[model samples]
Target chain A: MSDSRVSSVIQEWAYSSQAHTQTLNPTTTNHAGSTSQLTQMDMIPYSQSQGLVRGGTDDRVTEQMMGLSYLPYTSSSCLSNSSSTGTTNHHQGHPNTQQDFSSFLLPSLRAPVNKRSISKDSAEYRLRRERNNIAVRKSRDKARRRILLTQQRAQHLQEENQKLQMRIGQLTQELDTLKHILSQRHLHGAEEGVAGESNI
Target chain B: MSDSRVSSVIQEWAYSSQAHTQTLNPTTTNHAGSTSQLTQMDMIPYSQSQGLVRGGTDDRVTEQMMGLSYLPYTSSSCLSNSSSTGTTNHHQGHPNTQQDFSSFLLPSLRAPVNKRSISKDSAEYRLRRERNNIAVRKSRDKARRRILLTQQRAQHLQEENQKLQMRIGQLTQELDTLKHILSQRHLHGAEEGVAGESNI
Candidate 1:
């Protein structure tokens, strides 16, 4: 699939998940007005095209919509698991629906959805997703940078530790040498004392 | 002083320096044997006499010991500059003295020898100083634990950079609410959208 097409599907999925969330939870009413505005602004073109597709085969449309609806439920479930497992179960459950969606769209529906939604939801989705993608990328990059810095720091610390260990070895060696020198000096002093004793 | 007395004096200085380092630098060598041995063998006499001086010259002893010998000249420079530049010039001039003699005692020392030798020549000086103090504490800690673990990590990273900021307060508040509901319905969904959203 084309990059643009994949992004559009992801946006639709995001929107479906969001809509399901709004429907399931009423407390999100505070942002309802803005979300509805966004939906109307973003969804009108895609919805219109969807209306055109609706005319062709009612059964397939119903099945696809039903599958789309089920998506939000699964996605919501996936979102819930996101914290602990992170996309594992979501990815597991996603391929079936996503494959169905992709296959169904890949045929006659693909052309219409792509053309119409491209102007509206696709653009908005692309923009928003791009922005979000940038944010996620930035976040990941930042985390990566932190990890890189940390790794560098760890490397530097290990180097310092090695240097310190080397220093300790050197100091120990020097101390041994000094002790040897001191002992030699002590022997010389003892010999001098013996000579003085013999003369006395 | 006799050689035994000189050794004793050096050992006393080591003990005093160790005590001072423990006070100044908390995270240090974990080897308890040497420290405990030092305490039992060396500290008893000093502690007992400290009790005696707890009667007579406590303040004077503290004062004198404080001024005794910051033998790691770099450490003294660091202590001096800690209030100012932290660890600026420390690493630069270190290797010269450190590399030499690893055993040779310095002579005619520069600052009254502090009533004890604190020069680069002092093996005990390097060992005591380097073991206790590292140049990069915050960086090392940050690297060791990763930014995700520390509240201060966020603060420090934020201070270091202003670009990677997120709405932490809003995210945290939303997360708390989500976590509350998630705990309530954890059995029902067995998936976690809330967590995934929060991570994003």
Candidate 2:
């Protein structure tokens, strides 16, 4: 791929991360709680205003890649339901919201468009869409889980590290105390002089 | 936002994750270690063959988002030089090769296509491309660092955890020995029994 083109796409990613009234649906909880087509429809105009028609068949592919075209984002977004107002709630629910739009959506690849205007209504395209729908959900669920797991592992490790450091500290202190007592008695050899330390 | 459309994009993501001869550029080292428009052109036919013309001005945006548009991929792909044959090298160097093209490139959201036929040669598009190129590189570098840091932290924690466990074992053993000696003495005192169990 041309570096120039990648930059253009990333630029759109950067653009998408911003809270543009013309660009975003701006729902974290709303989208997740929303099981209706109405919620999807509500978000369409905003996505369409950005340039790609959310309703358009070709662009719908792009929408999925964005991770924004669909409703009911699980876990982080869906779990938290706050505010009737929009943009603020987006940040409130998901920490990786920018990553979802920018990093996650980074690849907005269009399969070499030899057939750019391929009939979206075609049976093959519909089949691809259905398969993709399943795949994306599975893929996203997997993605979300992996990220959460990584974060949890990191947290667990940090706590373990601190506990280890504390243990090391305790061991060193014990060794020092043993040395001090032996030194006061002018004793040599740890095995004999500090046979059991404080263990009787 | 339609589940069907999102699935379609993710299905492409799955497809992209695979080693499709026609669909992929199949370069990890080749793209990064070398630098030239010629190399970019060389990969064009493969990417072009993916049904989206790599040579097309309009489709270049999608190509960028796919994380496949550019000549040079830094770090994980660039650092290792293992294979001369194409597809093998892609997997050989980058562990997250699929993540790069699939998850990292996941967003692929297009600006709503109001002006679908935006002139590529136009100064505006050119500027956007230039800015995006810088942003993408920076963004990717940040992402790589984050993932690496997380992995490193987990490894470090595991090692620390083992060491802490060992220390706890030692401390417990010393405490047990102290108790045994105290029991042998048959002298039951509150503070004297367990005081400084292993600290001399």
Candidate 3:
């Protein structure tokens, strides 16, 4: 086929890609309307140890791991709501699935080494790029969330540390007062020291 | 080249690949002799917010984000130590970096659609596969580390909760003891109420 024909075919592929996405993501399509249920589950627990991310059945973790805000754009409205992050492209459909691979083809993205660089024009190359992009984003976001959650955890621990210190202070002060009272009574020559007066 | 010559060239490429990796990983090599210092830093904080993972400066996070056990296998002994996770490849200059993509070519990995499968026999195709493999592994290890860290955090929080609960119990018991003693003294017709006796 000539170059013009290939370009025309590419345009056709671009338009129908949305419809094709439904097929590419049957699992996601099945998951479309059930986001509300996933939201409820997210509120309960989202533990990988709990087997929340089983293979094939749903390699996807609980929506909590991905964050409700980052959950797949199961609908057009949800897509718009999550657009600000620009990280939602590969959220199991929602069109433009190839954008990651396409964007990755930045003219400046030569390999880190100096030997002959690889070609960029093959179908396998394109598909590999697409998957790599998806996985990379997924990985990076996972890292970011891990850091954020840890930060939150550190904050909580710090607060708890402060509270525990304060409680110890209060208890120590109260103990000091009680001991002082008991000692003062002894100095005043009461026959009964606090111990002697106490009937156990 | 003839088929036999091609096979010989492939062998040569494999051998020299290790030497070439040093070029691919100048940053990681610079980090090689300084791992002990990085270990000391690990005992402190490992926050992304603190700019611990500045791009290219050190795309790597703290040695903590990756457990010290998993810190790039920077030495030969370290490589053996990390053999169990089978994830030590792509740690800047490890050999056999093509495994992920090579493994990805399993016949079972045909596209999810009915379209003709992509051609996988070009130089660019192989390199892209190689890089994609590295990225996928990097991404996956990151995720595993994330889940593990969260698990550790959860365990620490649970332990703290139990300790706090025990502490509250202890405080309550002490308060009850003090209250009982005061009440008994009052019943014995002490002139001073415990509260009035306690001058702040």
lDDT by candidate, in order shown: 0.31, 0.38, 0.38
Docking class of 3: incorrect
Give lDDT: candidate 2, residue B77. Answer: 17
**lDDT digits (tens) for residues B67-120 of candidate 3:** 232233222211111111111222333343423232243443322332232223
> Which ten contiguous residues of candidate 1 chain B have the minimum total lDDT?
B76-85
- Misplaced by over 4 Å in model 2 are A1-121, A171-200, B1-121, B178-200
Chain A TM-score, structure 1: 0.39
Writing each residue's lDDT as its tens digit, candidate 3 over A1-200 gives: 11232233233223224222322222233233433333333333344433322333333344244333323323222111111111122333234453323223333332223222223333454355545644654454454445445545544564575587678668767866775765564464355334344532
What is the Å distance of residue B112 in model 3 from its true position?
29
Candidate 1: docking tier: incorrect
Please give the lDDT score at residue B112 for candidate 3.
30
Ranking by DockQ: 2, 3, 1
- Each model's number of backbone clashes? 8, 33, 0
Candidate 3: misplaced stretches above 4 Å?
A1-158, A186-200, B1-125, B183-200
Model 1: DockQ score: 0.01
Error of 1 at B20 (Å): 75
Best by DockQ: 2
Order of candidate numbers by TM-score, starting with the best: 2, 3, 1
